[model samples]
Structure formats: structure tokens, C-alpha cells
Target: AAAGWPLSELFDRQFASWLDLDPALDATNRVPSILNGGLGKISPVYWGACLGAAAAIDLYGLRKKRSDPDYFPGKLGFDPLGLYPSTTTGKRRMELAEIKNGRLAMIAITGFAFQEFVQQYAVVDQTPLLFKPVSDVVETYGSIGGYGM
Candidate 1:
């Protein structure tokens, strides 16, 4: 599939896609601190909270499924060891997971955005030099900056 493809054209298109990779690239450039800023603020407490929320949603879904009438006989609506299998045809054991976890994903995403926003303007950016080149960090700010390459 590499036949007759002009290097320049391919390069241009690829470059465009690269720009899309970090729409916030421009923003990161504008605000070096925030973009490069360390998110160490994502403390253990914050991690515990995210993990707790995700776990709570998982547990709630497990309980709901237990009473869902779809659970296998003699199995508390779980696959094994009181744990729900993420995938199964028997009554869609994880349907609740999709619903509950989907909501958690949304809430968590929103929370992350809010945290970044506040950190960008109000908090001091403490980005580590070693981490500045990380793809995720670059993407986070690049998308915000509308990085068009």
C-alpha cells in the first residue's frame, strides 16, 4: 500500500492528524506551567475517592443483579466467589455494570476536567521535567488549545 504515495502529501496529511493528536498543543505552548504543570495534586485521597466511587458503582450493580431474576440458580447473580462476571449471556450479568459504570465514567471525566481547570488558573503548575514529554499530559492540554499542528 506504499505504492506511488507522494512523500510530501503523505507527510502533510500525517502532520494534520498529528495536530489532532494534541489540539491543546497550542494551549500547552501558551501556558507552559499548567500544561507542564504537575498534577501531583491527584493525591492518594483523590485516587481513593475515584477508586471508591468506581467500586461503589460496581458493588451496587452487583447487588441489583443479584435480585435481577436473571441470575443463575444458586448463584447470587455472580459468576464466582461473589463477584460478577463482566461478560455473560445468562441474563446479561453485567448490564448493570454498563449502566452504573458508564455513569461513573461520565462523572469522573467531568470531575477531572473541573480539577484541571482549577489547577490551570488557581493552582501552581508543578509539572516535572521528566513527565513533560508524556503523551497523556500533552494530549490533555493540546486538545484544549486546539492544536492544529
Candidate 2:
């Protein structure tokens, strides 16, 4: 309403994109209701909390892992920092390494948050959306980082 950019079109495009993304659920047949089609509406709040936690970790500390080679999964060949020190040296290299590590960690955190939301909210009762039934496993059986059931 205030700006030149059309917010309506932005939402419409997102709606169309999601509808198209899931071939099983098309825009023609599917629409929001009391229970369903509200997936994108409600989950972002919770997901943002999860990502925020990751951001906080990066901002605060636990950066000891940045310099520690044993911290990263070298055995798995996953060098998150990519801090070879050949291209960059001294403080800049370390800064870049930390930034890189932080990004990778954030990605992992976001993905975990997405899955956690899906497991907690997406699948209902006992049935899972797919295999390896994670339905309420965390809330019912286990807890993450002392987040008990």
C-alpha cells in the first residue's frame, strides 16, 4: 500500500510457486482451509526461532572450534571453513574461516529446524509423511538440548 513494489503480486507469486513446487497439490484443486493449506503460514515463526538460535551461537561464542582441526569432520572430508591458509593468511584468513564455518552451521541449524517443525507439526497422530516415521518422536520419546517431551 505504501511502497511502489506490489506486495500482492509477491504473495501471489509465492503461492503459485509453492503450488507448482508440489505436483501433488496444485492451485486449481488445493486452497487454504481451517486445518490444511496453512503450512507456510504458521511454521515460519517456529522455524525462525530455530535459525535464530544458530545465529546467536555464531554471534556469541563457541568459536574455539574454528581453529581446532579436530572440531570439523576431517574424516568425512567436510571442511566447512575451507581455511587452507594458502590463499589467505593471518587475521583475514581466520575471519573468513569463522564466517564460512558460521554459515555452514547456520545451514545445518536451519535444515534441522525445518525437519523438527515438519515432525512436530506437519505429521499428525501416528502417521508420518514418509518413511522412518519421525512422528512426534522428539516431543513424545526424546528431547533436543534438554527440550524434554
Candidate 3:
């Protein structure tokens, strides 16, 4: 249980660190390192290839599902990237697609890390927290004056 706790704590800390990193830095630095180093600890090249393949599959699926009317303005169909006008309806569809796909991808990737963390720290009893959850810890020492002591 003690061993598991530390592993859980480490995972929680690392995850919080990743969340706090700047988006640009995350892309250029943290992401590759975590994906390659953390996940890579299990399997490096395999995970990297999996990430690339997943993205490609997502792009291909999106391209294949595009409607004819979505690509063609009146009668002429645009072949280059098949980009259409960004109307309210179009924007809404795009947003929905992105949200749906993004969520699935996030879940999939996070699930992998979570499994690894649990496996690595199977003996731990308590999980780590980014911040203290108890109110007393956050409150001032002198501020416990209200109500009944």
C-alpha cells in the first residue's frame, strides 16, 4: 500500500504539472517527453507510432465523412482541402466534431497513463492530491472562531 501511494502521488503530481504547462511548451516539450518518456518507459517507438496513427486515422475519418454539398459551392466542388464557408451551422458542426473527437482522444490517452500508474503503484493505499482537500488546511489558524469550537 505504501509503494502504491507514492506511485499514485507521483502520477497525480506529473499530471498536474502537465496541465499547468503552457500550450505551446506542452506541444514542443512536455508532450513529447511525457508521451515518449513516461509512456515510452513501457514502449517508446510503439507509443509514438500509435499517436501518429491515431491522428492520421482521425483526419482520414473526418475527410471521408465530408458531404458533397459541404465541399461544393452551388455546382463547383473545391478539391483543395475541401474547406467550405464558415457559417453558423458549419461552425457548430465543426465545433461538435472537434469536441467529440478531442474528448475520446483525451480519454484514451489518459486511460493508458492511469493504467500504467496503477500497475506501477499497486501497493499504495492513498492517492496523491495537487492541493489539500480539507478546509482546515486552507483556512487561517486564527480564522476558526465562528460557530462552536
Candidate 4:
């Protein structure tokens, strides 16, 4: 049991590392805000674009995995948990798919957040002029031009 403990720890670390590198697992914070906010100051069109991009990323991962299951680590045989006596079976493949799907879900969630962010913060036209450059006025009108005029 003692010897098996170290192996288990190592496997856990590897699994975590692999998951981190998986593109499907990557989740940006931007998606959630848009979904929650639902187009305030920002444009709805931009939010839709962001959501579309996220969907594309997710689809890319699925397509890549389908094309080559071995594209990811632990595909052939490298059981992290040692729960299975052998990793060469349909069950192991299903387990891998489950893990991948979990990551995909996270990606999707974050993508939604990103869409929200776009809607909340993205600038539309320059009509309102939230914060124009004071320097422009200073330069055009001159710092002391008011007194002279």
C-alpha cells in the first residue's frame, strides 16, 4: 500500500497536468458575464460573436478528438487511479470521454461568460463619449485660450 501511494500521487499530478493542457478544458472568464447581463451598454451583436467563437473552439476539440483519440495523453494505457486492472477496453475509453466532456462543459460555461462580458463592457458607437480625451480640448482650445478669447 505504501509503494502504491506514491504511484497514485504521481498519477494524480499527471492527470491534473493533462487536464490543464487540454484546450477543451480552458475556460475564459468573459463568457459568464454576458449570459447573466444580457446586453446593457455593450452590443448584442458582439456578444453573439464571442459566443460563436467559443462554440467554434468547443467544436474544434470534439473534431480533433474524433479524428485521433490518441491526440491526448493516457489514450493507450496509463491508468492514473489504477482502478482498472487493464486500460485496454471500451470502459476506459468511456472514462476518458467522460473526463473530456467535463472539460468541454467548463469551456462552454466560460464561453458564455465571455459573451456576457462583451455585452456588458463592449463599446458601440462614440456618441455618448464616456471619457473623451481632455488633452484634445487642451490642444485645440489651448490651455489659456479662454482668457485670451
Candidate 5:
């Protein structure tokens, strides 16, 4: 969910603007590299907040545990539907699902890397379904040969 949220946000016009990405201007065979430009300027604020959030969560967990000796620190018992089973088989299923989700997220990140390496454009621009048809995109930006490769 974490990786997917950022990926989706990159395609969102307003969110991408907030992240200092201008789809219209960024549509070119420009290599992705270390932080620079407007993104570089705002990156510290975004990452700093993420670090602060993590610290806050840790402090809250510690305070809760200290206040209640029997308190479970990690799990919040968040299953509203009570679907989480206590059985061993159910636990294994949950674990497998988590593993699959993580692997899928990794694959998605890898795909983004390769797409940038070849397409050399914003993911939103490279995606045909976003701004144009597949045929149009392939014509305008050839598959695997988009950046004169």
C-alpha cells in the first residue's frame, strides 16, 4: 500500500504538482538521477515528516505499553470484521498473503525502474491508458526504442 500510494500519486495531476513533477514539461527522454530541481527542494520536508511520523508511532507504542503492563505493543487489534482467525492455518494464509503483497510491490518498483531506464519519461506519460491510446503512444513513442535506443 505504501509503494502503491506514491505510484498512484505520481499519476495524479494535483499530487504530482505538489511533488514538483510537471507532466507536460517532463515528457521527454530525460534520465532519472539523484534529486535535483524543485523535487530536490521539497524532498527534505517530505522525508523529514515521514521520519517524524515513525518516531511518533514508536513513542506512542512505548507509552501505551508502559501504562498497561499487559498491553500488546505492535498489533492494534484492527480487524473490524473479526475475519482474522487464531488457527494456525489461518495465520499461514495471512503470512502468505503478506509475502505475495510484498513481492508484488517489489516487482512494481522494479518495473518502474526499467520503464524509466528505457522510456526515460514520467510514468504517466509512458502509460498509454492515461493520456492516449496504445497505438497512438506506440506511434509517438516507440516501444523499447522510445529514447533512440
Candidate 6:
């Protein structure tokens, strides 16, 4: 929940605007205030509420997971969709797949953050292939000149 607002804003074409928010990019100490500033533009009370919700979820999940020995983190009490397999091997495979996918997503997000930091450009604008079927963008913008090649 804490990441939802920033992720939404970034995906909604506010990626460039983030440069205006933290140009130097060294103000790690003021993350809360920065988050509040951006969130305040949409809703004055969103920041605190989101923080509270994140804290509550963290606390509740930790407590609940600790209390239940057999309760898997992703398992629903009742799988109405029957997506989960009954076999232990199938369950372990699903867990491993979930972890791997989560790790892949985290890596992608980290790469996006680094790209934004160094390039100071929106990933969508840089990644033309995502929005259209164009090869010229990669040809024109993929040069290594900016890295002093």
C-alpha cells in the first residue's frame, strides 16, 4: 500500500515530474515529506492513511503467520477457483514460482529506478516498443554517446 501511490503516479506520466520533486536525489532523509507532498496534491490525508494501512498489514501478517503453523502466506482458506493443487509437490512448485516471479518483478522495478535516476527520463518514453511497434526509437535513442562511449 505504501508503494501503490508512487507507483500509480509514476505510471500515470508523473515520472518526469519526480525529477522536479527531488532533483539532487540525495534527500533520502525527507522521503516521508516528499511522499506527503505528492500525495497531498491528490488527497491531504492520504499519506498518513497509507502509512497506517501498511503498518497494520505488516503487523497483522506477521502475527497471523507466526500463530498459524500450517498456514502458507499465499494460501486462501478456501480456494473457490481451484487454482491451488492438492499435492505437496505442486504446492512447493507454486511457491517457488511465486518467489521467482516476485524476484523478477523486484529486479525490473530496481532497473526502472536506476534508469530513471541516471537517465532522468520516463521509462515509457524511452521504451517505445512497449507503446508501439517502432524500431526507430531504439535506433535513435539507444546510442551509447550519453555514457561517454
Candidate number of the best TM-score: 6
Candidate 3: TM-score?
A: 0.26
Superior by lDDT: candidate 4 or candidate 5: 5
Please provide, for model 2 over 71-106, each residue's C-alpha lDDT reduced to its tens digit, 9 standing for 90 to 100. 442223344796445443564665566778878776
Cα TM-score of candidate 6? 0.55
lDDT of 5 by residue, 92-125 (tens): 7876777888888878766765666565555555
Identify the runs in model 5 with alpha carbons over 4 angstroms from their true place.
2-11, 16-41, 58-74, 129-149
Instruction: Tell me the number of clashing residue pairs for each predicted model.
Output: 11, 0, 5, 12, 0, 0
Instruction: Give the poorly placed runs of model 3, Cα more than 4 Å off.
Output: 1-80, 84-87, 120-149
**How well is each residue in 32-123 modelled by candidate 6, as lDDT tens digits?**
22322322333446557989998887777677788888876764355788788789999899889988888877777666566545554444
lDDT of 3 by residue, 18-121 (tens): 78732222221222224334333334566789899988766665665574435321223333776644598985676577678778777655654464344432
In order, the Cα lDDT scores of the candidates are 0.45, 0.43, 0.44, 0.46, 0.58, 0.53
Pairs in steric clash, model 3: 1-123, 1-124, 4-123, 4-124, 5-124
| Best model per lDDT | 5
Model 1: residues >4 Å from true position, as ranges?
1-22, 29-89, 121-149
Of the pair 4 and 6, which is ahead by TM-score? 6
Model 5 error, position 38 (Å): 7.5
**Regions more than 4 Å wrong, model 6:** 1-44, 76-80, 133-149
lDDT of 4 by residue, 8-40 (tens): 322434564677632211122111233554235
At residue 63, candidate 1 shows an lDDT of: 80
Candidate 6 positional error at 28, Å: 22
Overall local distance difference test of candidate 3: 0.44
Candidate 4 displacement at residue 41 in angstroms: 1.0
lDDT (10s digit) by residue, model 1, range 23-126:
22223222222334443423467679989998887777778766787543334334556455455573364656566776877665454445545554311133
